[model samples]
Target: MQRIEFRKVIDLSHIISPDIPLWPGDPPVTFDEVASPEKDGYYLRRFAMGEHSATHMNAPNSFHPNAIGIDAYEPASLVRPAVVIDLRIQARDNPDYVIGIQDIEKWEQAHGRIDQGSVVLFYTGWQTLWDDPRRFINADDKGPHFPGIGAATTTFLLEQRRIAGVGIDTHGADPGQDTVYATNSQILANEGIVLECLTNLDQLPAKGTTLVIGVLRLKKGSGSPVSVMAFVP
Candidate 1:
């Protein structure tokens, strides 16, 4: 058995609440009191939210009609080495910026080639806007605009590195303006998972961290909110 050791843990998930920015028309998050300590000797709440709410993972079925769901993932698939690519400066310069081969090559020059089966994450500095839904979504008549992976980058990661998944601190894996979900579809087509709306990415190193994702295994679920934590060595 492979032993796991870490000196610190960084929460890579956002606190799920009613106000986090969501896709344009997804169901709103709701929390209702199911029982109160005074009345039932227990405090419990029932919450409802879209599968891809807050910090969430996307199953292949999210974009593919006949693909497997999140529950199909095995325990080993949920724990893997993770690498964070810092693109905050570039994303801030252009919200529509698409991570491309040039970007990946540059990152590799500095960090090294991305390892196979690693979950690659992008820190676009978007998490800073989580408090303001409008700004976070950054939508207008033209549609949302945010830095994200595109078809080319997604394909490179899959074909070259054989990445297990891709993640970002934005609401969508594809750039917000991409209604077609180009990146999502490509990644999902190969049975790769997608993580979004992640937080605390600023606390992570460029590489050498293990991601232990906690996802709700809803049967045939297209996706689910997740509690992603990073094990820092």
Candidate 2:
């Protein structure tokens, strides 16, 4: 028999702080010191933030009616093989780009087909703009201007490919400027999970990596801020 060891664990989640970008009109994260070391001989703090803030996951019920909650996902389902589809070039050239079915086909041609239960993450290079909330959200009077998965592509992945879930380095799975948000609606209809606001995707290879999503097991939670990590062996 042989023993196994971890090669590396990369942090794919972003830091949750005041600087982190939040959805428009969302509540700001706050930290309060409950106890001081000098007074209580201990340090205690209380923090509060929206469930959808930072590196977070959307459960089926987040947008669906009476669907499963975040706590319902089994432990086995939280960890899965992951493939990073890089669209940095296109995203850099066009801020309002949407990853379409053609992009998925191109990736399948380069690599192998995306298997069932594999976590598919889109690398839009949006993490580079995280330092600036205005730019990261890319919003204006019209709406947001960030890259997202096209509705058709989301349908193909959730219905046809049957992937475990979809992850993005942006605000959400749908384009910010999309009024209808058909992609997100489609995912909800299928009871699909979504991981949003991911970071450090560049550190992982396009394939041959495992994604570990650590989320708070809040009962009936529509969503939860998650700590996303990658195990590379």
Candidate 3:
């Protein structure tokens, strides 16, 4: 007989709860102890929240009028090879920077080509400020400033790179200062999936890994909160 040993578990899910915080306008997630042994016969907890809070997925229906719901999304699509492209330097210098083709090119120059049908994650190191509302939102007299993909960059990935989806360590895949929501619109229109509010990307390697994302099966759901994990092999 042979004994088996597992390496390490890389938790990709962001902590969730009413106190986890959310995008300024989105409803806060809430949980209540509906049943307790001291108060009731058993112990149980009821939960309530918006589907789009915390680490979550954006279904095609999010922006398209006649697109498939979150429930219809194929399970195979949720699990795929993943790579992290570090953009902390760019994000630190330009809070409102939109990840572009040049960034992708630079990443490829360092870490081989991005494979087709792979999940491309942008690591901006923004999750460090998750506890501070001011820093998390980067709200100023002008407005919230954050890093994300631009319209052109997203279109390029969808059309040229043919990636499975895009993930980001930010509230949304689009920059907070975006007036038109260009990136989101493009992705949804192109039937592209998006994983948002991701954390702990810094803990994973740059390449040679797979990601497992479990999204709630909400009928006709535009999106749903997900438990994401990364496995290095």
Q: Best by TM-score, which number? A: 1
lDDT: worst 10-residue window of model 1 = 172-181
Residue-level lDDT of model 3, residues 120-192, one tens digit each, is 9999988887777568888777778899998899888888888888899888799988878777777777666
TM-scores, one per candidate = 0.98, 0.94, 0.92
Estimate every model's Cα lDDT from 0 to 1: 0.92, 0.87, 0.84
Enumerate clash totals for all models, in the order shown: 0, 0, 0
**In lDDT terms, how accurate is model 1?**
0.92
User: For model 3, what is the error of residue 106's alpha carbon versus the real structure, in angstroms, after optimal superposition?
Assistant: 0.5
Write the residue-wise lDDT of candidate 1 on 1-233 in tens digits.
98668889999999989988988889999999999999999999999999988999999998889889999988888999999999999999999988888888899999999999999999999999999999999999999999899889988999999999999999988988887888899888888879999999999989999999988999999999999989998
Off by over 4 Å in 1: none
A best-first ranking of the candidates according to their TM-score comes to 1, 2, 3
Lowest lDDT 10-residue stretch of candidate 2: 1-10
Candidate 2 lDDT over residue span 87-112, tens digit each: 99999999899899999999999998
